[model samples]
Target: MGTAQAATLAASLSRIVADPNDMVSLSDVLRQRQLIARMIEASQGEAPLQQVLNGAVHTAAQGCPAPMAKILEIDRTDDTLVLKSQCGMPAGAIGRTAGKAVEGNPAGEALKNAEPVIDIDVRRRPPESLPDILKDNNVVTSVSLPLINHDGPYGILEVDFPEPTQIGAFHISFLAVVAGVLADNIEKIHARAALIVERDAKAVLLREQQHRIRNNFQLIIAMVQRSVLQTTDDGCRKNLRDIERRVFAMASLYDHLLGLSVQAERADLGRYLSAMAASFDDFYALRTSGIALKIELQFGIDVDLDTCTTVGTIVNELVANSVEHAFGGSEGQITVSMTREADDLCAVTISDNGHGLPAAALESTGLRTVRLMLNGIGGRLDVQTAPERGVKWSILFSDTPPRKRGAAKP
Candidate 1:
């Protein structure tokens, strides 16, 4: 052949080789775009950790024909890599652990150097140098990338082929991108888990503090009762007893708040009202013997701490008055009921089957205190009393309203 003919032949061969290289470059670009799109979709998913791992492995395996794709996270406790998620690997190999030695393992080497490592032929390596899991699975070629970010090395991504396969620079580049996405997702999941732990700790602490406060209030009640017994004057003794009852009423509110399953700024009115009634029954039995007192309580709404306390105080005064004067030291029954009136309004009624109130209403100190408490909490009081029959007191209140008094019952 002449010199001109040989030169022409060389140029044609050069073009032939360049065409496949061009095609391979185009294929890599498309694979990179696909991996990026999958990452974005995975990030938007509800389960961040699962989505990230699955996306990383699926994307890597799709780009390269690998029989198995796995993600191994660094277990900082023991300084080893543990398999976290995998595709096409036996279930037993899911949690397999490997030491941090870079001598024979491609994953360890990649993580140690914060780079990508590819082994085209693993069968040639010494049996001792191969990981038992990989060898058992008959893996012939593998590519590993370190999941490193600004926070440093986190884990490793590995794709294993069952048969001898060649991995190019473009394939390694795709795996590197997948590793970066997985690293970011892992950090976010860890941060969220830490936040949940901190929140639970705070809740436990708050419950303990509330328990202590209730105990302290109980001590105060005991001291007041002691003072009541020590006083010689009838008036002074009665006043001390009243004070004790009011303190007990407040303590009941705290107990009801603590019993709730969920922590909130408000207390349940129904539970608070029921507890207060039970406490009053016990107190009545202890103070006055041989007198039967039956209390019927019904609740239908909930209120906040401040509102519950005010309402409880009012109920305490009303019940005490009925026990002291309504039955005139005889057997009687009292019914305490609460119901929701509107979207934000509620009504509570306390009634007794005994002699009714006197013609003049709001005559005693206890009644006056009830009226004041109701006013303070933006509530209204209504009294229905009949001579020689019975008395019923209904209180209407709103969740959010201006403090005011309603018309007196005639």
Candidate 2:
């Protein structure tokens, strides 16, 4: 502003004091910009609609001075202005209906005509009964700004000035802008609320489907275990154990899905082994008599689906061999660890602190299959064992494209 106008504004503002109850043009604590800023900041997120409305009413009164403000929601059904939120009004005036659409009601006229309605002087204006808002506060002039936008009419914003001359073109223009901002914010809150409900519904449906899938996995496991126990032949029993292990590992993938909102492409190797190994113990629970093998798995990296299947097969085959043959029914421990060999290559070591593999058991079926799976993944196996000592199998593979490997000499 120019020096002359700045002086004029400063002189006009000098009359007002620091009062939260009154918002005039500009006071030490109250100003138009601050009031509008506070009003615009009153979003309808998480907060109840009534609380948001009340906050906006108080903020609207904040100017370099604020006005005594009230918002009367338009009830279309009853054709009345219901007092919803107010600032600087007597407590009793809240929730009172400002009668219905009538001849002389400024607020009612603003809503009805969808335009601005002004009362030059509420003190001298002739109405049989003054609305509680006007009567209870020192309102000399009042402007009823209809809160409307492209959507529809929301309510009426009643801005009350203590002095009649305070109603200027600037004040009316500012109120009009703030009213639109409030209406837009209300509509946004409604849209977000609807979306939140829809998202919650989808989560419920997903959990239900996951529960059914888990049930199916348990049923399959039960059938495999029954077959393993019923068979007397060692070969048949071993084959059943293999099938049970595969199913157990597959179920681990399902369990992983239960914890997520979306499906994951990469699975944690350590988590999969923990679940599969636990299920493996349950499968042998009835047959094994003496010491159980305690399996401890360390940190594992994320791997794609194919790598998971390959690793799952190799790890289970090794674990099954230890459970069936190692310690010969005596107590022992199996330690599984995965570590980065280099930037692109990784290795998993499964070791059992038990009587080492029998000398006669070189190139067994389990070891042979381990070689085959390693070849498929461009991996190499280094087996360490000694009589009366434990066996450690370290399988190394690259996370990048699998390199070609020659078939092993049996």
What RMSD does each model have against the real structure?
10.4, 9.6
lDDT of 2 by residue, 63-94 (tens): 31355888888778988888888888777777
Looking at model 1, the pairs that clash are none
**Model 1 regions more than 4 Å off:** 1-56, 63-65, 101-103, 123-127, 149-151, 166-177, 286-300, 358-378, 399-410
How many clashes does the backbone of model 1 have?
0
TM match of model 1 to true structure: 0.77
lDDT at 111, model 1:
71
Instruction: Compare the candidates by TM-score and give the number of the best one.
Output: 1
lDDT of every predicted structure (CA atoms): 0.73, 0.68
Q: Which digits, one per residue and each the tens of the lDDT, describe model 1 over residues 145-255?
A: 777544566677899999889776556655655665566666667778898899889988988988998998899999988888888999998888888778888788878
**What are the models' TM-scores?**
0.77, 0.63
